[model samples]
Target: MSVDREPGLRERKKERTRRAISDVAMRLFADRGFDNVTVAEVAEAAEVSLSTVFNYFPTKEDIFFDRQEDVEQEWGEVVRGRKPGESAVAALRRHYFEALERREPRSGIAEGLVTFHRMIEESPALRAREREIGERGVEALARTLAEEAGADPDDITPRVVANQVAGVYGALYNEGRRRLLAGQSVEEAYPFLLRAARRAFDLLENGVGDYCIRPG
Candidate 1:
C-alpha cells in the first residue's frame, strides 16, 4: 500500500505546485496586464525559482493561459464521449447549455470575465495566441468528426461541418463575453444567452436554406 500511494502522492504534489504557480501568475496578470507581467515576477511572487516556473511553463504566455491544452482538446473529448444515438452537434450543444446553466467560466457567464477578456484584448501576443488556440480546437473537432464518420482521406465534409459547428459556438461565446464586458450581470444576461444559444443551434440543426431571399 505504501509503495502504491507514493506515486499518487508525488503526482498530487506536482499538480499542487503547478496550480499555485498558475494562480499567482493569473493574479499578477489581472492586476497588471499580461504584457506588463514578467515570468520572473511570477516566479518571485509564487515563491518559486525561475527555473521551476520554466519547468512547468515553457513561456510567459503559457503561464497566463495555462489551461489552453485542455481547451484545445475539449471539443474532441465531448464529441467522443457522447451518449448512444447522440449526434456530435447535439452532444456539444447539450454540454454548452449545461455549462451556461451552471454559470461556469468556460461558458463565459461567470464573474471576472470582463477583466480576463480585457487583458486578452489588450495584448497582441495573447490575441494571436488565442486565435491559434481556436484554430487548434477546430482542427481537433474536425479530426474527431472524420474518425467517427470513417471518411475517406480526400473527403472535406468533416472539416466543413466542423467549421460551421465551431463557428456557431464561437459566435455565441463571443456574444456572451461581449455582454459581460459591456457591464451586464450574469443573471441579467442569462435569458438572452439561452435564447441566442437555442436559436443558433436550431439554425444548425434545421439548416438555413433561403431564409433571406430577395424578392424577384
Candidate 2:
C-alpha cells in the first residue's frame, strides 16, 4: 500500500549485505540440504556474524524464503493495480502470461528452477514454510478483493474466489516444476506450459462461474 521510493545509500548497502547472505545460504542449502545447514554455518560461510544473520533473517526458513514477504503481497498487488476495466481474473491471467514470456522465477520457470524446487521437495521444513506462505498469499488476495468490492466482513465470496485462484496458480506452478523435474529443458517445456496456463485461466474465466448450480 505504500508508494515506492528510491533506495538511499545505506538502504542499498544493507540490501547488498542481505542479498549476499541469502546467496550464501542458498548455496549451502543446495549443496547440503536445508536441515543440514546451520545458521551459524551460514554466518561462517557468508562472513557475517551470527547476530547479523539473525538480524536480517529471523530463522533458517526465512533465509531460504527470503523474498516470501514480497511474494505474499503479489496477488493483492496485481488485483489492486489492475487496469480500470480489467477483471481481477483477467489481470492475473495477463500478469501470469507476461511472467511466463519473460521466464521469470516467479513464474516457476527460471534458471535453476529444478534445483530450487528439488530443494523444497526434499525438505519438510521448507515445504511447510512454503504452505504457510501460500496461505498468507490467499488471505492477502481475499482481503484485497473484499476491500475493492466494499464487501462486508461476513461476505465469503472474496475468500472463495481467492481460494479458487490460488488453487489454479499452484497447479500451474507445480506443472512447470514437474516438467523440469522430468528432465525437460525450459525451452522444451514452455509451449506445454503456455497451453496449460491458457486452458487453466480460461476455465477460471468462463467455465467455473456457473458450474453445478442447484435448481431452486
Candidate 3:
C-alpha cells in the first residue's frame, strides 16, 4: 500500500513564494496605483524573477484580485452545501448575514477605509475587470442552480434567478463602496446594507417563488 506523503518543504516554499509575490504586488498597487506599477518592479520587490511572478499570477490584475477565484468557489459551496431543505437563495442569504455578523472582508462592511476599494474605483480597467468577474459569478451560479433543479443549461429559470441573486450582491457591493467614498463609516454602512439585503431577498422569496423558492 502506498502512503500519500504530505506536501514537502519545497512545495511549502513555493506556496510562500507565490504569496509573497502577490503581497508585494498588492502593496505596490495600493500605494502607487495598479497601472503605474510594472511587473519588473513587483518581481524585484518580491525578490523573484519576472517569469516566476508570471508563473504565479498571469496578469498584473490577478495580483490585486487574488481572492476572485475563492469568491467563485464559495458561491458554489453555499449553494451545494445548503441544509437538506434549504433553498439556494436561503443559503446565500444566511451566508451574507453570517458575513455581516463577522464583518468579513467579503461582506463589504469591512473597515470602510480599505485602500483597495479606492484603487478599484479609481481605475477604469479594474472596474471593467470587476464587471467581468461579476458576469463569471452569475454564470457559475446559473450553472449550479440548473444542476440543483435538474434543468437544462438553456433553461430560463436558473439563469433569471441567478441574475437576480447576483444583482442583489452587486448592488450591495456598489452601495458599500459608494457609502465609503462618501465618507460613511462601516458602522454607518452596516444597517443600510442589512436592510437592503433583507428587502432584496424578500422580493426574491416572494416575487420569484417558482424560480428562487425551494419546492416542497
After best superposition, candidate 1 residue 63: deviation in angstroms? 1.1
lDDT, each prediction: 0.85, 0.87, 0.81
Candidate 1 regions exceeding 4 Å error are: 208-216
Estimate, for each residue in 83-163, the C-alpha lDDT of model 3 and write its tens digit. 766788888889888987777777776873468789998888899888888888888988888888899756798888888
Q: Could you arrange the candidates by lDDT from highest to lowest? A: 2, 1, 3
Q: What is the lDDT of residue 185 in candidate 3?
A: 84
Judging by lDDT, tell me the better candidate of 1 and 2.
2
Compose the digit string of candidate 2's lDDT tens values, residues 28-122: 99999998999999999999999999999999999999999999999989988877667778778888999999988777787788989899989
Q: For residues 1-216, could you state the per-residue lDDT of candidate 1 as single tens digits?
A: 999999999999999999999999999999889999898999999999999999999998888789999999998888788776677777788889999999887777787778888898899999889888889999998898888767788988778877887888788888888898888998998899999989988887676222211222
> Candidates' TM-scores?
0.92, 0.91, 0.91
Clashes of 2: 0
